[model samples]
Target: MKDENIKKVLLLGSGALKIGEAGEFDYSGSQALKALREEGVKTVLINPNIATVQTSEGVADQIYFLPVQPHFVEEVIKKERPDGILLSFGGQTALNCGVELYRQGILEKYNVKVLGTPVQAIMDTEDRELFVQKLDEINVKTIKSEACENMEQTRKAAAELGYPVIIRAAYALGGLGSGFADNEEELVKLAEKAFSFSPQVLVEKSLKGWKEIEYEVVRDRYDNCITVCNMENFDPLGIHTGESIVIAPSQTLTNSEYHKLRALAIKIIRHIGIVGECNVQYAFDPQSEDYRVIEVNARLSRSSALASKATGYPLAFVAAKLGMGYGLFELKNSVTKTTSAFFEPALDYVVCKIPRWDLSKFRGVDKELGSSMKSVGEVMAIGRNFEEAIQKGLRMIGQGMHGFVENKELEIEDIDSALREPTDKRVFVISKAMHKGYTVDQIHDLTKIDKWFLEKLQHIIDIDEAMKKCNINTLDKELLRTAKVYGFTDFQIARAVGLEDELKSMRKASLVVRSRRKNYGILPVVKQIDTLAAEYPAQTNYLYVTYAGVKSDITFENDKRSIIVLGSGAYRIGSSVEFDWCGVQALNTIRKEGYRS
Candidate 1:
């Protein structure tokens, strides 16, 4: 049941799309508004992003084109008198503004209830010292760190923690003011910058080479908790997750390791009293199986958005319902429309998220990625295997590269240093080193990337090498099928097998390869991403195309007028969520006109 007392809800929006925080909040905030509308609640949305879906008419009862600042929010709260306000749906900008309003007694003065994860819970997770203390209460392992208030305290803390520590600003988003310092001079500089962003800084021992893992977890007010998805960062702990390539359903972890982390994530969220959706990040020593709870985001985060899309679970929608005093068992899964929202989602495919950077658009910017985020946006690709998913993600980033191995080689004087110190081109560098006969072990040692990922990348290279010796006429059906299974696009296969130069047109060569592949009975099949993994029958239209499957999940209605709408794939400099808003609006319009979209 919905909370009848919350007749009017004030929804804060993350204002404008920028680096570190973009598009994901627009997606989450739109879902929240939809959920509120479903519950017959009057929603007042405050967002200055004019091109977002949430700012569109009919999304909310009232739309305020105002910045999500404390003063503006306080003024709106006084005028609107909403019974509840949702802070967790927005990104850090709105969260920080809501916290400021709460600090100034504005919400209390106006008698507005903060919905979803309580303000105290958000503060506990935002403050490094308090987060550690909260986790300590449950005997959870956390990174060894000291919270410092000033430069003097930071220096002393770094000395005590020893050299090569990471400095993180508390209450910052997307690792906003965070970096690694190897010496006193670097520590002083990093700490000063961190102090500018936040009043508190955390100096912690650096787990540079450990695997960075994350879990998207959800909990209800009655203490029912479930882990929706777990992801592994292709880059190790030194790089920020926003800057690294990420894979969902953790490809490298053993069953024991996966379960251990999953259980711990549930424990931490339950202990911290996270009422809705949240994510926990970890740094795991792969060999020792020891781990550190890096941090927990007590809100719908970027990872949450990816997890929701990766699985067929609507995290933001369900989280909004949970915030309105509904139990997990009481709510139905919106995608399936036939199951309870309490169960964990099981995936039958892999998802890879590659970050998109517009570094070249600017002049003289350092391209190296570190603890702080530099990626403006990311693309999530789904496939039947790791190789296919990563390659699709690489292409989806709109970088002019054919899947991993066929890309142009970078001019690196030192391959070892290029791998050791990560840049946006590190993935391409790995492929280059492979071409130069670098062993998987050597690459893994230098890059600190997992051997499983390296081997899969090597497999792609091995296939390309095999194809180099064969022309389109000589390429057998088995070889073509194998390439397709591993995510080689027709264009990539054509280029590899000497068809590109022969035809002088990539489109013609790709069409020839496609025709041959179709004749050989190798074609892409549609697969549904039902949360149940086919254990139970579900009718979710959420689907993806993969070459590994034999049959499509849903039969096509050839008689109906079906219109395909293309979303703006991956937010970049020129395009962002505005095009996504356009696509969604088009789909809605098509549906209203009695057409399938």
Candidate 2:
């Protein structure tokens, strides 16, 4: 039954901004809608989150304020009679809702075809053990793992695999109920927590301190596939990529290793038959740098936002067009303005993302980062040279001209000792190393970031030391702006200035982030990460990644606009602090863009 007049799409959107499932889906879902509308396709979006830009009426042909439940989506399905349903945009919530719709026979009863992936494909990729089996069939190097339903099963599995296993509760989000436990006691504690999250759990060898890499791949109905962008996390394999400070195009992978992982990404997408978009995560041994496949998310994810923003590829847009049977070649490059859709994005410079944590307010939550990630937001920085980019990124984070200020007064801590154990304050450890007069080369050998970036931060530290030693008060606005970018609070500045009211005014005026039109037309203020609830299972999480810009139509309150670079999201008890650094960056970027601080 090939209906020739298929022009409408039904979108299942992530609902509210709850704990586990927060706002990133809103960005992807919003982008998908914009892409569809650009192609003149009618879009019917059903989401309960009113705060999101996607739920707006103009973004879609028809908007519905509905729960993600299958029955509710089915009702929209019956009324709108869409040509097909797109489950690719929204996060796991939409996928699960589609699963229910198919299971309840609503989609079947209505004869509505699933657009991007069929019901069977979703089931195959989502079921952890099933996905692993499929990957094994393809000879992919997955971790030795098992799905256990109870305490007895967990013990038996641990005994066979040996101790110090990684436990992940099936269907849990953001590493909830996941940890590295050594021996019976720790295993029992982790198992209890995991099983509590879900009846089934996955136990495998813990691969901590390994190299963590993420790939964004897209495919079409014609079986043509292309790798869009690849990212590497600064934190070793054990930490979740989301919670790590990530750099795009990997600063350290040998060309061969990078290609090897890219090939695997293509193969997995083909095997799973994901037509539109997918994310593949890989873990590599730090010593040998050996690569092993982690899990393949069969839908758009947070990384997709970073990938799209970094590459200017518009992944969500191409994916939506692909779902409508448009081949990859038919979709043009949005950023490069190229006609060739087969080409992958190549970076002219480096892009880094520091995960922002909301844990500053919590007590005894263990600031240590680990095999699991616990950050709520992230910030991206770009540089032509590593050091300048590091400084720029630091400034972008509103951390007081971060890498530009010299003589970083650090509370010296041993980095290797810190790395051996994960902490929520890992960035501080990196900062402390720089403050200790460790050369950038030395830092790179230890931390795995480009030496170029380290050198830039070191330059800032050098400058600061000179300023303090010589009492150089080069009191220019530009100098002040640079200082502010590096994370210098007015209190700290006040310490140097002996001006309490000046510092107080600086805090009150508080910086706000605004975007300027880049030469490439990419808005600097791109999006947000809502990970406060990413760790829950089969629950809802919504993250919003929006473009912050201006019409040049200005209004002033007391001749000053109250602006605060909204941090990525709330740093829950388990989330880390890099995202706060991200918020710091955002504040600086706003000031740099000429917005009032």
lDDT of 1: 0.90
TM-score of 2: 0.76
In candidate 2, which residue ranges exceed 4 Å CA deviation? 1-5, 18-21, 371-373, 398-401, 404-419, 437-597
**Backbone clash tally (model 2):** 60
lDDT of each: 0.90, 0.68
> What's the TM-score of every candidate structure?
0.98, 0.76
lDDT of 2 by residue, 1-597 (tens): 122465888998888654335556777787788877887778899988776667754678888998988878877888988878888688878888888888898877877778876667777777878888888889988888988888899899999999778999876666777888888999998888888889889989877656788999999888899898999876676677777777876777879888999999999889888988899999887567577888888778878888877666778878877877788877766544534566676665566776666665677787766555566656676544444444445545444433444325434346777734656554556666665666777666665554544555675565455434422144344444444444343333433343334445544322211111122243323222211112211111111222222221122357555475555433344432344434545666677777765
lDDT of 2 at 443: 64
Highest lDDT against the true fold, candidate: 1
TM-score winner among the candidates?
A: 1
Error of 2 at 546 (Å): 24
